[model samples]
Target chain A: MTGADRPGEFELIARVFAPLAGEGAFGLVDDAAVLTPPPGEDLVLTKDAVVAGVHFFPDDPWDAVAQKALRVNLSDLAAKGARPLGYLLGLGLPDGWRTEDAEALGRGLALDQDAYGLRLLGGDTVRSPERLMLSVTVFGAVPAGRMARRGGATPRDVIVVTGTIGDAALGLKLRLDAGLSGRLGLADADRDHLLDRYLLPRPRSAVAGAVLAHAGGAMDVSDGLVGDLAKMAAASGVAIRLDASRVPLSDAARAAIAADPALLRTALGGGDDYEIAVALDEDDCDAFVDACRDAGVAATPIGRAEAGRGVTVVGTDGAVMDLGAGSYAHF
Target chain B: MTGADRPGEFELIARVFAPLAGEGAFGLVDDAAVLTPPPGEDLVLTKDAVVAGVHFFPDDPWDAVAQKALRVNLSDLAAKGARPLGYLLGLGLPDGWRTEDAEALGRGLALDQDAYGLRLLGGDTVRSPERLMLSVTVFGAVPAGRMARRGGATPRDVIVVTGTIGDAALGLKLRLDAGLSGRLGLADADRDHLLDRYLLPRPRSAVAGAVLAHAGGAMDVSDGLVGDLAKMAAASGVAIRLDASRVPLSDAARAAIAADPALLRTALGGGDDYEIAVALDEDDCDAFVDACRDAGVAATPIGRAEAGRGVTVVGTDGAVMDLGAGSYAHF
Candidate 1:
């Protein structure tokens, strides 16, 4: 579990990917992995999968399952402004575990592939019968005319987002309920910063090329935020809404919502938040929250996009309510 | 089991990726997997893993488990000379199975991602309690001065291969001994071409850039041509020998080695045989067997490269015979 202690897959990939820092030139211990682009750019591949009781909770903390499987495949290559470049894992592991719990899940995948300049390049390991499964697959490049997509949102765009959203589904309802940890008396550093944002979720690949140089459609919320903005408003056919008091919480979610307001249903049905939700264009929403307050990150806004389709919301007597649906779907 | 029946995961990705056909440029339903490079070239990557009773046969056949998980990840992007350019799956399933056997294993992974031009892009699916596991990765591009590596073989190279190698380990020991299938008199089209090379092991990515424009070290024969040419003679440190009566066999391996010479020990330790083995340069081994007979394929040569380190077999009175300790290693 995040209590850490397990390291061997090549010494946890030489201490989590031999200290990251690369911008392509290939060479990630041969047999394959070589990228190059970056003088006009193009590439953008992506892949995701993290099952274990269907994605996390097999005692979380193999360094937050190797930083939420390399920040949810670097939030789908930072919703397409790409850049990152380098990744390819597939792990499985299960037979009575331990090879140092797969060397602390390969030193949490070589510390998020050396903190993102990536280059774990190739991978594949097996033996499974239950749980522990990863499957990353990243690679980026961008710049062949700003990437972004989610069927290029429209109906007057605007949604926004970026950081704070249901502290990773209220840190998975405080690790799957003990009656919501004595109904939110949750201290010990606000339950270890909401269990490290549901086990480490960074990937805003640092404002992916200034939201693909402004935004119009993008994604990465890993479900919830009303089921991934109802799958980016049914892949951009359009109709959004929102409001329920402009969402953005976190002062440890208003002290666990003044100690239990049904912890606002884990801030509207929690879901691992790798952030970046975008859509923008209400004149690039105040220059995209003033370029996320001059790149300190945090953006926000929360709703717009209308004209026939799903989402909706409003509340506080301002009519229309029922936003239920949450995340983790399986069927 | 592979006899069909069981589906869902979008009807096994619309029946194995609705008849695939990619090379990227928007396909596998998009949002990544685009690749473009050609007027220059570079991208290359690899990944593998197959597990289920550990790589095949828990009653195999979800279309040869989606064609040996996209032919052992396009045999590591055809041992690195790159070409395919797309792939990324991570299935795991098992639990009240049958959505058309997970759409016959997503129509055997969209018929090997439309027979190798890859493009499946996004992936991940969970739930497992019994067997079935896969984890491909692939990608390719090469050409920045023709890739090819393994520590460039030397000391008089010339080993080669390409096709026919103990019919996928005697079609997985006649698909796990049905009392050695009536004592190996085979036939049923030589037990369905040696159990479809033990369930689909092809990946030669159309002769990976003609084995890096004519070998000097290459790989991809999933362990067994004397242990992947002694890992291409210990990653080109060099010593290989072979000449076991010039390998290349198939009349269903000379009618199962004229009814058992212990089926050439299942073709010297029957591993998958995604073929390709290379080494060449004893003057480009007859122009790499005339560029695999001008691309009609089936190269052969059987072996060479010496000056010492391991792997040995001499016979016809030249003594030194130890064809034992090589293939089948997992621990």
Candidate 2:
């Protein structure tokens, strides 16, 4: 059948998205989904969008594209110390989009929904004239008044991060410069690791309870750590001093940076590393680390908040490092 | 300055969207907005998207585009018998978008936020390679277990619709066929009214409380009253018989139809009216109408639900009308 004669919007939704809907979704037929928060809980709301060719290569796998769209929003919830409840997806498909690709996208979303213990709540699908764009509005729940806020960090707070940073940035470099992976003298496995990190983010949701219990301020490190940290510091009305060596890097990133020290700037300032950066009292560091460890997440102390402004990154030689354009801005 | 040198994303958000942020929004700095639903309430969630060429003309006013995006989602909440709490926006701007246009979009959103008693919570902005697109996910609140569902209608329920319909469909015709307006012998004001109805939808949020209290089932008439009624009928397992002569029409629409007798099918089947269509018991119809009247809304009883499936529209001639397509569908 021609595109117009194919399954219409409602039939497509029923065949693809209906099974993903949870109890509150009214099987995707109702105008709106009903969500009853647990007693005394607060709803955490966040929205993120990914467009083909910008957020991901247009040629990327449809499943990975769908996963990346949902995972990025889930990363925000993880930073805010909230557990995933459900998400609403806004999908804009190009005119030539195939039913098989749509099904693949649904399968990708379904996989992540099962993995994250969340369900589709409600959404809208429309036809676009050009590129495919996906927007996800994630709903999460945390105990009342207990969500981590970016403005809560104070002087002397320990700055910590979950998982490695800069892998995605390096992966992006490899994606844009295919030969760079070999130039960095990296193993095949290391190259694959960086590429996977760029393609799919493992949001640190498992440690959200611990982060809520201990973090004073937090945010997901999406737009490169240096810029994101500067934002967090500005929001908290404090200064942050990062030991550049302490910013966790995967083996692939380390190999690339070692091969060309100039690559460190990209590692520090590239975007799409969906790791959680948080600040807490120095005294609570050990407990938070232990908690994250128990939750199967690796937590590392990267720096400290100080009673000043902006961000300062120190090199291994104890000299301040000048990193140009500390973060990614999509202006 | 060129587009690349224009205000960065954060600066743009601060100058425009930050002012629209309400309490618990953390001034748009926090990763997620925290929403505390009033005790014994259920949170309602809905999302809608509009693309540049698909939903609006590429050259449409940025403010009107923004308003259309938010208003469409608000229409969903109104149908579900919920009060607007807040909304999250995901905006994808083309590379050459002007700063002034961005500000205009923000102003448009702010105007509606105030008009609707909602606020901006959180959102993400990204760069699109081609056309501008916007997605809005709205949150509303209703008393626990009181949300209007699509499956609540029963046999013998009276079918009612709030405000006028068909103006938008004709407005769309006027939009696409500029010559058709004069052919329909519409006055300048009537022409403008039809165009405005097509450009901006006034969601029936004013009657939500009354709808929740009195309606058995309801939905906003977005995809034409005929098709949307069929959907409600299928969901509620009841047949809907709509008297075409009783379907409310604005003066502008009436003028157009008077000039063109064949416009009736377009009036009943064209989309984008955004009025609420509801079902209630015949015994409660008068009280519901009075309640809507008190709220400054006009309610019209058009038909009744019966034991069957699908929808049958009776023409002014007392004959069944055959609308080739029951509703507008985006495939």
Off by over 4 Å in 2: none
iRMS, all models? 9.8, 1.1
Candidate 1 docking quality: incorrect, acceptable, medium or high = incorrect
On the 0 to 100 scale, the lDDT of residue A33 in model 2 is 94
lDDT of candidate 2 over B119-186, digit per residue (tens): 99889999976888999999899999999988788999999999998988888899999799878789
For model 2, residues A59-116, the per-residue Cα lDDT tens digits are 8888899999999999999999999999999999877888888899999999999999
Going through the candidates in order, their DockQ values are: 0.22, 0.85
Best by lDDT: 2
Q: What is the C-alpha lDDT of each candidate?
A: 0.71, 0.90
